[model samples]
Target: MSFLLNEIAPDDPMWNKRGALYAPSGEGPTVWAADDIYTVKAASAQTKGNIGFIEATVPAGGGPVPHAHTDEYETFYVL
Candidate 1:
């Protein structure tokens, strides 16, 4: 089965001190930019050290290179 555009979403209750939306900053360690690419999303801080996540808009044929991870597992959910 498939889902519509509005059917998929991820909300973090820990977004703010009072359930507010989390804002991405322009100048922070979470912000990365290069080669016409820009992304500011949560990876670990939002998961309380349990998981890492990010809602990124990856360009065509544009993604991160392969790397190794011995202590963590990765999952990709392309909604």
Candidate 2:
């Protein structure tokens, strides 16, 4: 397995910034095909034994659909 840390700029265009906060995709979900409404602030991902992290934000009432990972276990902690 491998581990690494990654950073994303809050001002990144991927997350449209409006005033002081970032707005959800104005182009709609088709742009990213994300089922939920959120802005990626950070994440810990694993692919083929490679691990990495990212940062993001999730707007209120936005979250992932109810699903399970068949190949791995997943968990969430409310902050």
lDDT of 2 by residue, 2-75 (tens): 22334445455654345333434433122122443332332332122343222224568665556777876545
Q: How close is candidate 1 to the true structure, as a TM-score?
A: 0.47
How would you encode candidate 1's per-residue C-alpha lDDT over 1-79 as one tens digit per residue? Answer: 1111221123544344465446555421233343323333443545456764554556777666767678888777776
lDDT assessment of candidate 2: 0.39
- Alpha carbon lDDT of each predicted model: 0.46, 0.39
- The local lDDT score (0 to 100) that residue 10 gets in candidate 1 is 36
Off by over 4 Å in 2: 1-50
